[model samples]
Target: MQKLSNLIGLPVLETVTGTQIGMVEEVLLDIDQAVICGVLIDSENWFFKAYGIGFEDLFSIGRDAIMVRGSEVIKDLADLSALSSIYRLQDLTSKQIFTETGFLLGILMDVVFDVITGEIRAYQVSDSIITDLLYGRQTMPLPQAQVIGPDKVIVPDTMAKLLHAEQIL
Candidate 1:
């Protein structure tokens, strides 16, 4: 498991030529399916106008870098923003989260996801002042989280009762 935010900025190295291509700029997530499609690398070769590798093509992901088989497989689908569910963790960072009933929860701090399966496991949320003074930070179960839009996320109000401040620290 790894935090989605951490994947950004990791170097992408081509295995065949050993060329350091670029750093991961964003995470392409199929949010409706809750799976990671791939990563968007802002490549050094602007002329090529294309550089993205699917998760299946990734040789390995480590603390240092991500290894891909070769450059041949990297596609040039430049405008992935058109894809409705193309969720970039960086785009959602610090966004406000609330309950379906319009109760503000807090800001979205982080996401814990499976590196192997690309499934999001939990959301580490910073609580709003009223709740923060009571529970501090809370890790909401994935089932409770509902992304209402780009600006806010909603979790059921009852979701807060499932855990106390002691569990999160």
Candidate 2:
């Protein structure tokens, strides 16, 4: 699978028409499944203002080409809310994770997907020290954590306190 970091900042070009679509800004993952469902495109105008464009107006016409429906190209527009939700991220290996205290926990190992709901259930952490200490000779699933932002996943202080108190096992 392609890594998210590799795709980020990469220029999205149109193969058929040779028109440049835009660079990927952020990737939207299914909260329940942790799988990437769409990508957010950078649609700031030449003056660096966000132009709001709806997803319906942006269609993928070719492998690399994304065509806007109207006469105005994205670069000329100033509103950007609609363009923000149009692109979807296809990969998910480079998402970062951290502890509530701002400690580096680990990178995302994989996303658990729920078949019935078709969403991300939990995130898998790949830290060897934490995994070995917590599981201890048995395999256990990664702890279910909350995503606080696009770049931050936080285990609540209450949950962290519980885990520290040995109440969660």
Query: What is the model-wide C-alpha lDDT for candidate 1?
Result: 0.73
TM-score of each: 0.80, 0.37
In angstroms, the error of model 2 at 2 is 2.5
For lDDT, the strongest prediction is 1
Clashing pairs in 1: none
Candidate 1 per-residue C-alpha lDDT over 1-169 given as tens digits, one digit per residue, 9 for 90 to 100: 6777788899999888998888898877666777777888887577645357777778888878989888776776567645877777776678787777888766878777787777777677776667767756677666434665767877787765553342431
Model 2 TM-score (2 dp) = 0.37
- Report the C-alpha lDDT of model 2 over 35-94, residue by residue, as the tens digit: 444445674443354432233344442233334544243342323323443223433444
lDDT of 2: 0.43
Candidate 1: lDDT of 3?
Answer: 76
Candidate 1 RMSD computed on C-alpha atoms after optimal superposition onto the true structure: 3.5
- Candidates in order have lDDT scores of 0.73, 0.43
